[model samples]
Target: MGTQFLTDEKGNKTAVLLPIKKYNKMIEQLEDLHDIKLYDEAKRDDDGTSISIDEAFKIIEEKRKAVK
Candidate 1:
């Protein structure tokens, strides 16, 4: 394991310490996994309704204008 555990006076685990690079890598992997889960859920619930790229872009532009 790429971690060191911090202990309390009773020798019980309190926290953890790991290299910065390893922590960053773990965070990146977790983000990727979350994206995959979202994609899977979207795919599972997908309907036939769809739009072209230009249409989607136009809708996004309109929403941005409304936000401003």
Candidate 2:
């Protein structure tokens, strides 16, 4: 990953320039972290409204069929 900094006329660091690949990788990592946080929050909740894996898969398949 390569990076360069943009500076003001007063030589103060203002912004950064990163390789597109590095920027994309950073975005993916942030998204993954967000997913993990959501999962953790859901796990900590005790409202017993969860469905079984089979039932979940059935619902997903039904939705896919409806879309098609």
Query: In model 2, which regions exceed 4 Å deviation?
Result: 57-68
Positional deviation of 57 in candidate 2, in angstroms?
Answer: 4.7
Per-residue lDDT tens digits for candidate 1, residues 1-68, read: 68999999999999999999999999999999999999899878879686777999999999999999
**Candidate 2 residue-wise lDDT, 11-40, digit = tens:** 999999999999999999999999999999
TM-score of each: 0.71, 0.72
lDDT of every predicted structure (CA atoms): 0.94, 0.95
Query: Considering only N, C-alpha and C atoms within 3 Å, which residue pairs clash in candidate 1?
Result: none
